[model samples]
Target: MGGKVLVFGGLRGSAEPRPVPLGDLVVLDPATLEVERVVSGGGGPALSHHGSVPLHDRWLLVVGGWDGRRRLSALHAYDLAGAGGWARLEEEEGGGSRAPHAGLSGHTCTKVSDREGGVRTQRRFASLDTLHVDAAARRYWRNPPNPGRSDEPKGNGRGLIERLSSLIASGSASPRTPRALRHHSMTLVGPFAVLDGGECFNKASDTVCNDLFIYDTRTAGGRWYQLSGTDSEMKRVGHRVLVVGENLCLIGGRGPDGTSCSPEIYTLEINT
Candidate 1:
């Protein structure tokens, strides 16, 4: 919201997707094109596919993502007003700080409520009340009108392989849940979170998918609708999507052909 841009952990630039974890907190001056290191400790969370959102006037919250070997569930807060550094969210439990969920990466968390404030993280929709999420895989069930957070126990929620293993064990052998995506962007649109094109490796098909979907935050029934509009035929990944007035502007991304990057810019006129 200021002149400076706050950059969190992300993968190194590459044409093809590779696991390159970067945990540096950087501040960039758009006008001057200067860079500054914000995290001075050991380092920021060395993670990729993580999602960050502005917490308060002076803070930004970095949530779930991959940490090289495994997915991480630790909640980290970066101080923007004070000396910029990373700090984990500690809750008083038995005179000690207990850890939060550490099972997801490549997830998205958005501030859905202002009066009863909370951050909604995805992979599977879960409601945890204490500003701390414990049950990493609460599944997308019908929640109440008013969301109440859950205080489940600490556990490594199921990953893609694990879930698939379970389905195979049960003889169902079907892909039920949506695949995890990387290099994606989600923009808050009124009561909806508009998620545009990103890269997702479909283990079932062994192919990459570049699709768009939208989630309505106000609904008790957690549901996502696939969005297909103008230029939706063009498969795009790692692109920039922004809400401009009544239209959603989609900028450059990896083209569907996979040989080159997309140079064309397109926008979908929001009917609402």
Candidate 2:
């Protein structure tokens, strides 16, 4: 993630009516923009509209997405170091489960820490299912059955739930959790998970929001504080947001009407 760039399954844009699904995992040189290597997505299926995040800056964790016709339940990881390739990480909770990710697309995955009230964790909500975790599991891809030193936590790829439990155990999480949301923007700012607008997970009303919510990862239960104001009323979806200094820079994204809004960068002033 820091040195090289990774590309996973997507569609072939040149396809007629719609892009055809692809399953190749491509690694590229960040500077030269040249292809480093391409390989089959290990035993994973071709996917698009999925959520991906870097784990330890060495592996790419890929979770739920459309496998062409239907929503996929598999989770995959691409190793960026050594001779690692793609590896499908799964768990046998309750004997069998597919939607362990709760729909990963449009969700946000964050790396946080609640250790000794210091920090070190990851979590997911909605479509985001944090994967690609742990530096010790670098060799996991080479052999799935025999992960050797890969512990049960990292091996099962449950970084999200595991870290969330740890955070709650730290007695810093809020007692309540936010409702399921998709296409929302959630970023970390000083141990706090700040969330912005996204459509309701229900999709029945397709309600896009323009409010702000903050979760103090240092507290129990997933409690959040919602910020309301007159100026923070621009309904957003498919947008991107990041913390810049003391402000939040909202980037290009379509609005509720499903049309691209004006070419403007919105800023939200945040005090701590």
Candidate 3:
């Protein structure tokens, strides 16, 4: 319920209780509300009320949901190019199972260009890396952290002689392990991917955040800053967000009370 909702295939009726979550794929045209059945592979377990997003070209990436009884961490990609069928990607090795990952249902998953050319460039594909956004942890662990930073040296200026000795003898280096984060929302701002608005659950309920983060492939050092200037809303959970050009459109979602489908829309402008 706290994931993304993809408008593909076509809009169908409200999901009804059925055996093995309905495998039917319905996408809302946004123009017309007509329900159309996009080709779903053979008789696989019916998938309904799950998170889906457009991947590369004509491919949809689906992850996590209740399959009636148990929650799923299975990562399946549906290729919409030919006669679309489901292909399961290998699960993350040490990463524990993920469920109800935010920004999945009713949320938006965008394909961002890692390079300046576009998404189709080979350079972009070479930089194609998976970012695991742990909503509960409030951090992002890039599969391969920035190589340049990961191999940098660290430590305060100590004895100059000792520092020089250590640098030469041991090749002074500081490796930063990938981190896990929670409560953050990940979206694409033009060619850059932005991770914003989440709290680090360290301090006792006092560390809620409204900070904005930007990761650009061209830049060696990423950028992070608090969203100032305007009277912005508090960081919220269960809110659905979609990227339309340089603007991010946030829609109805659960507040402090509970889950809501009210017709409220908020737009955030980004320079991209």
Candidate 4:
């Protein structure tokens, strides 16, 4: 969140769709673009295509990504100001922790506020909770809904979404959790977390969307608005939406063709 440039393990010069994931944490000099320090084991659970956000100013919250084999629901935290390395957040299970909800990959986790709450419904239990990252204690708790649930074909209790969408970026037939985006981009603007251009998880969930979908962070319970009837001719993914004054600008990103990266920039007008 500060002026620090933090990087986790990611794919580099690989042709395979699901290449071996990396788990190293590195900090870079913001001015010189040079490596400052590298923590070998700070990057928890070899991950790629994950979502992350800064906590306070010395911690990073990484959630839900592909771990070389399958999608992971684990949320790992790293302490930048200390030397404790990585920590896995979970519930009490034989003195170990576990995932709290169905796993997600290529999804985005937006930071609304330090304190927020939401309601969740599971196969058995309906829980009311929120995300809690304790920077002072250097620990993360699964105050989120649906404790100890998994759907990655890892044989968890009553797993959901048995088949992976054909649109998954990995180009595999692996089973994944519901709403697992392939490689979308999401950004926070004003009061909404605007989601744009991502691979569709399944036919039942959503189709390949290039249009704008806004989620009101004011309430994490239930409120998703889609701006349909946009220019369907241009399909974008892995793109970014920037708020330029009263207008939102769409920046450069590879088109749906997966080859040509558009050089033009366009602004979007939302009727909100």
Which digits, one per residue and each the tens of the lDDT, describe model 3 over residues 1-272?
11223432212233444435446554433224354445454543344334444543355555555466654544466555566566665534455434333222222233433221111111111222344443222232334322321111122212322432332235332222112234345554432444444334454653434444444433465433333313334444434456542245554333332222334456655321
TM-score between model 1 and native? 0.58
Q: Would you list the clashing residue pairs of candidate 1?
A: 65-105, 73-102, 128-149, 128-150, 129-149, 129-150
Ranking by lDDT: 2, 4, 1, 3
The worst-scoring run of ten residues by lDDT in candidate 1 lies at: 134-143
Give the C-alpha lDDT of model 1: 0.53
TM-score of predicted structure 4: 0.56
Residue 206 error, candidate 1, Å = 9.1
Q: Estimate each model's TM-score.
A: 0.58, 0.52, 0.47, 0.56
- In the range 111-160, model 4's lDDT, one tens digit per residue, is 54544311121111212334555554544444444322111112221111
lDDT tens digits, residue span 210-258, model 2: 7667675444443576654344347787565654333456754556664
Q: C-alpha displacement of 220 in model 1, angstroms?
A: 7.2
Mark the 10 consecutive residues where model 3 has the least summed lDDT: 116-125
Q: What tens digits encode model 1's per-residue C-alpha lDDT throughout 95-193?
A: 222444547765566655443335666553333323432212211121223444222112322232233233334643322334566556676655445
Q: After superposition, how far is residue 1 of candidate 4 from its true place, in Å?
A: 1.9
Error of 3 at 200 (Å): 5.2
Q: lDDT of each structure?
A: 0.53, 0.54, 0.39, 0.53
